[model samples]
Target chain A: MRFSIQQPALLHMLQVVSKAVAVRTPKQVLTGILLEADDNTLTTTAYDLELGIQDTIHSDDTNQLDVSTPGSIVLPARYLSEVIRKLPSDNVSISVNNNYMTSIQCGQVEFHLHGIDAEEFPKLPEFQSDTQIQLQSELLNDFIRSTTFAASNSEVRPILTGTHIQYTDGTLNFTATDGLRLATRSTTFDDADTHNWTAIIPSKSLSELSRLLPDNDTVIDVQLTDSHSLFVIGETYFYTRLIDGTYPDTSRIIPKVQRTEIRVNVKSIASAIDRAALIARDRDNHMVRLEVQGQKMTFSSSSPEIGNVSESVEASQKEGDDFQIAFNAKYVLDALAVFDNTDVLIRFNGSNQPFTIQQVDGDVGLQLISPVLMR
Target chain B: MRFSIQQPALLHMLQVVSKAVAVRTPKQVLTGILLEADDNTLTTTAYDLELGIQDTIHSDDTNQLDVSTPGSIVLPARYLSEVIRKLPSDNVSISVNNNYMTSIQCGQVEFHLHGIDAEEFPKLPEFQSDTQIQLQSELLNDFIRSTTFAASNSEVRPILTGTHIQYTDGTLNFTATDGLRLATRSTTFDDADTHNWTAIIPSKSLSELSRLLPDNDTVIDVQLTDSHSLFVIGETYFYTRLIDGTYPDTSRIIPKVQRTEIRVNVKSIASAIDRAALIARDRDNHMVRLEVQGQKMTFSSSSPEIGNVSESVEASQKEGDDFQIAFNAKYVLDALAVFDNTDVLIRFNGSNQPFTIQQVDGDVGLQLISPVLMR
Candidate 1:
């Protein structure tokens, strides 16, 4: 089919769906983006089997697009994006000539690219279900940040590689762990209706969706079929298949009580841990010990090759008894960076047991790290 | 060795010398920076054998340096840079408490790093020369811009991997060639020294020195010895060993005669070549053809698998006769970008002969690119 569209509008849609267009796709067709124009909208879709994205744009300048006939074609993603990005951002005329030549004309510049018939493109899975939930764009992005990092990245244990989501009545919960660290975040969804639902979404897909979401305070509609889940933000729709397996009960891995807890400024603790990490990198365990005595806490790490470091910092809380514990510095630092709080309270049950880190004021976000074997 | 220096001053020097310190050096001492403090001046040096840098800084708030005995110590470059960068930009106190204990204190943050005595560090080449030449910093930096890119970067061609400079009788000439392309620029020194000198300086070292030069019109001294060349700018003395063997005769490769010449606007020609190169990338030759007839020139390139394209551009010169020539579009564009003229005259002796790209109105720079064979 033949149709014309504005150059800038087409470029916008290409950027949205081009994320899934792998440079080294096993199937050559997956490297191309399928474009279709009908009525007053042009839709582009790209998929690499594991994940897929579709984006649509509405046009007002019909001259840029004149539908001599209605059909579709798959054009190379990278070349098209480059051509349009270099074009002047004015009214650009784009049309399919001879059902094969895709031409874009702006001022003195003209670009012509070869196109593949849309019939050869793989069909995108049809996601149809009634289980749709609403989530604020910012809050959902934060939820992904808080828990996605803990997901096991290895494909050997496919179930643990995904973040488990549990929802009931008016609340949605997210949990993930990579055996060394566990993270959980839950938020209230006033409009969430259908109760008792659980699904394991791949951490990678969740991160991609979080990065692509708009910065404004808009509501994103999340829907899940029996086997796949869809996240629709603005004019783009992102879909990924659910991990088919069972997730472990991580509730028991985090400590339920604490014998001693201390409140340390988030920035100070983060900086101290960063310095300790420099020395910890030379060690196989990458462990750093935190000793709390009264209101003064000391952070230290040692390596035979890089020598040892000991830093003393003050905290707001001192209680119970003096104690020292060692934990993986990377996991704890990664968890604390996502919080925008002044202070964080780290609780310890014993030197050899799992420890919990939470915001000092309230349990707005919770993170748990399993202690490593350290001597 | 004991000294206290402002964090910013130390960080700046670290950044300058760290450029020569490679992260993966087999000699452990090469990965560390040598710090030597005596009296009121603190000197720092970092070397990777082929290139080295020594910078001295004077500070008042850093105390009297308190050198009980003058000594040298080598410390890891990356770790020191990172630690100093994150520290507050105030006076920092440094002391050696034990044989290996190195402690740095600034505000409430302190960093302790292991250090090795500086006797293990490589000896920097000394420049012993009575003859010296001076050039404007801005001009030297700009000259580097006009020639560095053409130098062959492959280590196998050691001589071609460096920019060759020759000065005699007040005129200083710079030449570089990477086999496929050559760039040459010359300027007259006001001193009118009758001494002749030649040296091959690595392209990477020249570029680094160019970027670090102060942005002013001050004259920078160029001192050359048997095996080392020094560019002492302000408080920093940059040294790089000269590559052995004679540099190729780039002067003879430039064509002195022409059969057909065409003058075109530099910006228009650059843009067309850039666009045409996009399509030419699919072929090994990456050949883009230029046909000049009357005052209009056409640039065209195509692949059998990817369609073909031709665009018409305006030109000002049409001498001798109409002709067509094919050249690697990337090389042609790169050479054109180095020209500061608005319009350039492209001269060709024949369809397959090496061509010269010169400023249409000036003679500040000249670039030559060898034509590629097209099949």
Candidate 2:
């Protein structure tokens, strides 16, 4: 198999597919990206069992390939990427001579790499269900930003490490939780399929895929199976395995009725958290206390060795008795930052109860942060 | 003591003085900066025993401070600096109540901190030296860049970590070596103190001083002692201890004879080395080899477990005959980057001998890289 393509075009496809190529995996082939050069197109695919990425690039010239030989070879992603990026020219020639040697040539620079037959790569799964769902790229990405940050990054519990995406009738909901905090985004999908579906995809894979989705009015095609889910946009396809466990019901953690509802400018609240973080960063627990009363709020944090800080701000809220609550400054800052709106309504059930924060007029998403016991 | 200063000015001075505070120094007190507020100047000083930096900011308004309440104290550099950076206003009011507490107030935000007695800070040595040498700030900085990179950072031999500077009459010379590579830079001072002087200053301290030098054409004052050197420029004073042990005689390592002399574009060679670095980064020993044969030169690197690459380039120097030498790519690239000139002349003595490279124009600086044996 032989092919000649623009260096940039091939390099772009390599970077896309190489995301699935793990540096050190149990399976050696998972660490390499499989390249299949055909008559007019070059397909690069890579998988690490949990998540896989496949992309294809079409050349401008039909003469780019001398033969229509459909053969595949697996090459180390990192090294192959380096070779292409350092090339001195726009177009690079790539050829495979049987199973042992794959040569890449550009100007006076040439690289001959030893490669394994593509058959060694894991078999690709077919999306058997035709019940594909579609959503606007921008809205879908917004849903990801609202939920992905709350996902448990530490893989102590594999199921919690995945974000649960559920769709039914005309509604689409995405949720992520790290036990301490839960973030959910829900919206009406005008083009949603009638079929009921739910899948727990690794939050990291969705975060990475969200970056690759098209912008603006472009639509993304999503397909779900019993074992895995797929997201397709243009020439790139991302597949992630579904975690084989039931996601915990998070509805109970969010309060249906808040004892006090305070509306504060998001930027003002975010800045307060940032200032508190300077001291919080030195503490062992890294917690900051937020005490809300009638029409005033106090932000305070203390480190035994470094003294203490307490600042107050005039805030608008439902007239009620005062209550105190403490939460991880890191989480509060992150949740507050997700809103682009001018003001956010922070609702609380009590001092020890989980708190819900949402944009003043936005019921599209909700964030719940559990309070830490500040002695 | 009470004073008010702009936030940005305080932050700027904090960044420079904080550089002398090491994160993991054995003496915990050395991690704090000594702040002395007196009259019209606010002086912030930091010392790590081996090196010291003190910088002062003058406030035009007498309201910032009163000479009647002259005071001195030490506080953690990182926290104070971060607090000032996160303050909500342009100007901050700092007042020391008694000698036990320090308060910084800005807008509605206030930060209180415990301060260490200024008496605990190490005293600055009274530099008593008869020989005084001065040079352009840019020129002194240039000498540092030319030779400091070759200093050994290894703790096995503490003396090798210093760069030796010698001044006699109107000529000043600097040199550093790490057993393998030796670099030297020299320049003439217009009015030197007519006596020979030699001292070895830790390269790390000199590096910090080099970066902090002002970007102006004015000459910097140099005060030298048998054990320490002081660089005073305007309101900033930098002091560094001199290495007591004798520095090695690196002048003997430079080869006087050569079998090959190559004149090549410095940028092209540096780029080639950077590209070769991709493969060498994964290898056990980060080394790349260059083979010169007549008009062509071959650059190659290989890892047994990975792959190998060999590329040839037509050289302007064909008189080198044939020879192969290997060297650490990182070191070579760093030294080459210091040369801003286009054409560089490389001096070679067989394949095993240490070679020296210098700019075609007499640039006063010379870089040497030793060849590593490939086993």
Predicted model with the maximum lDDT: 2
| Residue lDDT tens for model 1, A1-375 | 556666667677788888777678677678888888777677889887777899977656543555556668788887777776766566665667785788766666666788887888887667677788777888888888889998998987898889998887777899998888889988766764665678999999898888788766799988887788889988898988899978898877777788878887888888887777777863566788888888887888877777666678898876666878887888888888877758888888767888777887755568989877666
Candidate 2 residue lDDT tens string, A1-375: 677777777788888887788878777778888999776678999898878999987756632433356677898887889888887756677878755578777766667777778888997778978767887888888888889889998879988899999887778899999999999988875653358788898999988888787667687889988898888887888998888899999877788987788888888778877887777754555788888877788888877677667777777665555799888989988888789857888888778899888888766599999999767
Give me the candidate number with maximum TM-score.
2
Residue A202 miss distance in model 1 (angstroms): 1.1
What is candidate 1's CAPRI-style docking category based on DockQ?
acceptable
For model 1, how many clashes? 3
Shift in Å, residue B84, candidate 1 = 2.1
lDDT of 2 at A31: 83
Candidate no. 2 TM-score: 0.95
lDDT of 1 by residue, B207-254 (tens): 989878877888889898878899988888898988888988877888
Report the C-alpha lDDT of model 2 over B182-263, residue by residue, as the tens digit. Answer: 8898877566335788899999989999988876676888888888899987788898988888887777777887788988
